[model samples]
Target chain A: MKTGIVVFPGTWSDRDCAHALLEVLGEPVRFVDYRERDLGDLNLVILPGGFSYGDYLRCGAIARFTPVMNAVADFANRGGLVLGICNGFQILQEARLLPGALLRNASCEFRCEWVQLRVEQSDCAFTVDCRPGQVLRIPISHGEGNFFADPHTLESLEANGQIVFRYCTADGRITPEANPNGSLRNIAGVANARGNVLGLMPHPERACEPLLGGDDGLAIFRSAIHALNRVAV
Target chain B: MTYRAEVFVTLKPVVNDPAGLTIRGGLHALGFESVKDVRAGKYLSILLDEADEDQARSRVEEMARQLLANEVIEDFRIELQPEPALAESRGGGPS
Candidate 1:
């Protein structure tokens, strides 16, 4: 499947995502600059991590207004598969493509470490290869990764199974200590109600190969490819 | 006429302010024992050229709603004022 990785000023993860998709997965991928309004034809769009717009005002706040985001919004509205990682997740929330907002970590520190994530649901386009309650090792790097939502919105997300992943222990136990960012309910990832769009705080692209530590993140990318193939068929 | 506006953006009451908590902790370390709480926020100064005060107010309000603040997790207040020199000139006009 063809994939597009969006690159915004101050976005540092585009190359990593490109390497994961092109070199590792052998998928056709290209970089889409933030100034471009046209996304062209692509099966998937990945918003990679980094301090977009230098994390000015707030993380992902200024970059959300870039011209390409309008196109991204339209693409998502058309039911295209969109994956947002790290600051990209923050951008998705700022664009209102996803519910909730990411706030400063409870520890008030920029945390960079490997964390375990439990797949909460596998029905979505991003996590179809993962089983419910399956644990995956991934790395997270960010300062404002704490996710928050209002009571009503949080309830709807839970009821609709929109929560896709949660911070968990290595052996798959969900506990407060496993929550590196103090995210509400330990949410590490979430999908839109339709499941076509997903935003997460972890860097799956950075974990796509054993050389990078582990290949646990490959399942997420492979799952998207499988979903796209299904659509093509 | 030009209007100057100061916008204040703060997190919602229920939202956790980690930075504010750290600041509070720092104050405590410095022996500010009487400090009850500290919540940090953002302040922005904006200048707008509009025909009237009402128009300027509306414009600034829209800016705050659309970009200056994310209302889902934060609240914003706008303080609007006519340019000081312009206000003085207007007063002088009636002299």
Candidate 2:
């Protein structure tokens, strides 16, 4: 599968993301400069983590206006698959591609650590390889990863099975203390209503290399590849 | 014409404001006991060279909606008037 990774001016994870897909998953990867307007031919797009636009004015405020985001929004509107990691998630929220917003961590400090998140739904392409309640460790580093949505929106997300992942204990039970960034309902990731676009603050690419200690993130990428293959069939 | 644009962008009240909170704490320590709540945001003054007052007001409003503010969380107001014949005031134009 061919994947496109959007690299904004301050994007720091473009290489890691590309390497994860190309070297680890054996998929062709391309770097998508945020200044470029064309998406060309690609099956998936990944907006990797970084302090885009120096995270000024708000985490994702400035980066949302980049030329590439317009194309990314269009692609996702047409049912194209997209993954947003860390600051990318903030960008998605700032763009209104997803509901709610991210606030500073409850402790008002940047958090960097491996968090165990339970797969809430496995039917979507990104998590199809995971079983409900399956635990996977991924790294999260951000100051504005605290997700906030109104109670109504949260309820709708729950009823529609849109809540895809949540921080959980090693045994896969969700708890307040397990919440890494004070995200509402312990949400770690969520997909749009159509399930084509996903925004999460965890850096799955950071865990794709086994030499880095774990390759728990491989399944998410592999699942997307499989989903695309199945659709082609 | 001197176009008056007042830009007010505030975080949604529900969203916590670390900057505001820190400032509040400082104010308390400095003995500003009367201050109850503080929300910090940017105030922009823009000078417009539109043909008429109405056009300038409309243009400033467009800017507020598109760039100056996030419609979801912030609110803004605009005012337009003829420029002062003597001196250029430094506040309330556009941002």
Candidate 3:
């Protein structure tokens, strides 16, 4: 599987993601700068975390207009697997590749710590390795990770099972106390309708190794390879 | 003629505004009991190079739609302000 990670002007997690993919996941990943106009060659495109363009004018607004986004959008359109993490999630939403918007955290504080996430849908290519109802420990570091959607859109997302993950307790119980950002319905992640594009506010890349505290995030990277295999077969 | 436009962008009623709520709490703590609420939003001033007011308004409206405001959770309003005359000097004759 050919994998590539996008690097925006203010992106800081690209190297971390690269390390996880190369050393941990054993995937030969390449860096695609924000100025690149061709994403038609990759199987999986990862948008890593950070304050893109200094998060100015809005977190992802400026980056949405970058030449790279247009290619990413086109790649997603033709069924390429796209995974957006943290600020990457914000950019995906701003680019309109994913529905809903991420707002300021309800507590108005930048939270950086480990959190529990329940797998809501394991049918998508991005979460295919995770079992539905399984809880994974991940770290989230952001001040604006609140996920919000209009009533109709929210309802449709639920009905269509587009929600792929939710912030929850260690025991997999959904509660307001476990919601780090006060996202609607405790949603922490979502997959586009076709299930190829996934966006989540938590940094699974940060937890890909046991030395980092836990390797629960390994399943996501495993799922990426599995997705490619499924397509290849 | 250059036209000045002020744009106000705020979250929709159904969307939660955490920043605004925090500001409200700060105001209440400052002994301002009369302050019932605070809703924070973005304010931007755009200087237009177009000669016609209608044309400038339309262009700014497009800008707001495409970038200045997110249609999903926010609404935007635009107001045209009078252009500052270049002929006027600062402080107008030094008080």
Candidate 4:
């Protein structure tokens, strides 16, 4: 898989994502600065997490207006694969590429720790390798990861199976105590209606290596590879 | 002619009121026992680009919709006063 990581000024996870793709997944990965407007050569685009623009005004508010977002949106509109993590999720919301918005955590604090995410849907390229109800241990670090939408939208997401990941306890039970950000329905990730675009609060790249605690995240990247390989064949 | 607009945006009532709760607690400690609820919101005083009262009102309302407020979770109200009176009230010499 040829993956491109969008580098906003404060993107701290681009290197981690790139390294994970190259070193762990053995795929070609490149850094695409926010100024780069072309998406011609990339098979998958990853919007890594970070405190973009220092989270001023609102998280992802400033970063959403970047030049590259237009290209990214165009690419996604053309059925390209896109993955957004953490602040990247915020950007996706701000760009209106995804439904709902991210608000400040109910605790009103930055949460950073390993979290269990249950795969609710496996049809998405990013989760094709995952099984329904399967749980993956990943890291989530953010202050405004609380996902919110209107009741109608939430119902639609649930009905359409676009709700892909949810916060779960170690034993795989979904509860408020297990939801780190107080998101409605304990939603930690979601894909677009078409399932080509995905945005999640968890950092799968951070957990790709076994030394980092678990290899649960490796499957997410390998899933992308599997997707590309299938497309090529 | 000039117009002054006061715009207020506040969260919808159904939304959680954590900030308001904290303020109510502070007020109770300060002996303001009659204060049952206090919702915190933003207050903005904008100098209008137009002077006609109706025109200015519409313009400010448009601004509120486009930027000052998120229609999803908040609502805004606009009030317009003559800029000359606003300046006088501010203790500034007539313009």
Candidate 5:
């Protein structure tokens, strides 16, 4: 399966994503510029972590208007797998490909630390490799990662099993203290209702190597590859 | 006609405003104990050409809805004013 890693002007994590996908996982991947209007045939598209467009006028707000986003939106509508990490998640929400908005952390500080994530839904494309309630150690580096949604939307997400991951303790217990950001319901990641688009704040690419702290994030990518291979066969 | 739109965007009442809260805390530290709450937001000034005041208002509203404000967690208000002097100064130059 092939993957496309989108690179915006201020994006800093594209190379990390490429390293994880190409050098670490041995998957074919390419860098897609934000100015490009077409996304070539690819099984997965990744919006890596970074301050796209300098994170001005709200994180991912301006970046959503880039030419590449139109193609990404169309690709998602056609059921192509899209994984948005950090700012990518914000961009997806801003583009309305996903629900809710990311607000500033309650502490009003930029937090960069390893946090535990409890996999809430294993049936989705992004977490198919993770067992239900599995805990993964992934680091989140951002100031605006507080996820917020209205009551009705939150209920729908829960009912539809769209919540893929939540902040939790090392032992896989969900608690307020475990939540690095003040995300509602400790939501660290979510998928669209169709399950094809996944957006999360954690840097999975940054955690794919054992030398980089851990490899638990590899499951997220491996899961996407697994899902893509299933459809190809 | 040229119109200037001053748009104010703020978080919804239910959404937590961390920046606002921090500001309130700072106020308390400054001995303003009676400060109940504070809500921070963004202000934008946009200049556009339209046929009439109604058209200008509608266009700026559309702009706020489409880009300036995210309805999911924020609300926006726009104030429109005609800029006749600026329009005259342009003297029918390129928009």
Candidate 6:
């Protein structure tokens, strides 16, 4: 798969995603600058984490207007696989590529720690390799990861099965305490209505190497590659 | 003509405003017992050059809707008035 990672000003996780893709998954990667207007035939594009545009005005708010994001929107409209991580998730929401806005954590504090995620559905390209109801160890780091949506939007998302991950315990129990940022319905990640784009708050890129911690995140990347191959076939 | 606009972007009351909550807590600790609540919002003062005050009002409303405030979680109120003749003569709007 031709994979690209977008590098935005003030975005800190772009390198992390690149290293995970190249060193861990061995998926040769390209770096697309925020100023570029063309994505250039990339099959998979990622918006990595950190405070893009310094989280001014709102998280991911200012970065959404960058030149590259317009192209990213077009890429998703064409069914190109897009993955948004952490602040990237916020950007997707601001760009209207995803529904819902991420707000300040209910605790009003920045949280950075390991979390357990229950695989809600394995149907989307981002989660095709995950087992239904399986739990994976990942880490979340954010202050504004709380996800909120109106009742109508939430209901439709549930009905369409767009939710991909939820905060949960080690044994796969979804509880309030498991929810790190008070996200609605404990949502940690969700896919777009078309199922071609996904936005998640956790840092899977940071967990792909055992040297860092665990390798469960590698499966998420591997799953994307497998899904891409399936599409090629 | 120059027009002055006062725009406010406020969070929907139903939405949880974590920062506001923290500020409220601080107020309570400081013994401000009568404080009912504290909600954070954005305030913007914009000066516009338009044909008339009505045109400026409509233009600022669109600007607030599209960029100054997020329509999903926030509501914006715009108050517009023509700049005073003296201020207009000085090439400025009400600050």
C-alpha RMSD (angstroms) for model 3:
2.8
Tens-digit per-residue lDDT, A1-233, candidate 4: 57889999999999999888898878898888898889778999999999898986567877887899999999999888999999898888878899987876777678999999999999888899989999999999888888888899999999999999999998889999999988999999999999889999999989988899988988788887888789889
Error of 6 at A3 (Å): 1.0
Worst 10 residues of 3 chain A by lDDT: A38-47
Worst 10 residues of 6 chain B by lDDT: B86-95
For each candidate, report its DockQ versus the true two-chain complex.
0.80, 0.30, 0.82, 0.27, 0.82, 0.62
Docking quality tier of candidate 1? high
Clashing pairs in 2: B2-B83, B5-B93, B45-B94, B46-B93, B46-B94
- DockQ of model 5 vs. true complex: 0.82
**lDDT at B41, model 3:** 96
* Candidate 3 global TM-score: 0.96
Best-performing candidate as measured by lDDT: 5
Off by over 4 Å in 4: B1-9, B22-35, B42-68, B77-95
Over A1-233, each residue of candidate 2 has an lDDT whose tens digit, in order, gives: 78999998899999999888988878999999889898988889999999999987678888999999999999999888999898888888888888778877876689999899999999978998888889999888898898888778889999988889899998999999899878989999998888888888888999998787688988789888999998989
Candidate 1 residue lDDT tens string, A1-233: 78999999999999999999999989999899899999899889999999998898888889999999999999999999999999999999999999999999999999999999999999999888889999999999999999999999999999999999999999999999999999999999999999999999999998999999998989899999998998899
Clashing pairs in 3: none
lDDT tens per residue, model 5, A1-233: 88999999889899999999999999999999999999988889999889998988889999999999999999999999999999999999999999999999988999999999999999999998999999999999999999999999999999999999999999999999999989999999999999999999999988999999999989999999998888889
Clashes of each: 0, 5, 0, 0, 0, 0
Residue A193 CA error for candidate 3 (Å)? 0.5
**Can you write out model 1's per-residue Cα lDDT over B1-95, one digit (the tens) per residue?**
87899999999999999989999999999999888899999999997779999999999999989889998899999999998777667567655
lDDT of 4: 0.86
Shift in Å, residue B80, candidate 4: 5.4
Compose the digit string of candidate 4's lDDT tens values, residues B1-95: 56779999887776554567767888999999999898877799988657478888989998877566655556788878887765476656755
Q: Rate residue A34 of model 2 by lDDT.
A: 88
Q: Which of 2 and 4 is ahead in DockQ?
A: 2
Q: What lDDT score is found at residue A196 in candidate 3?
A: 94
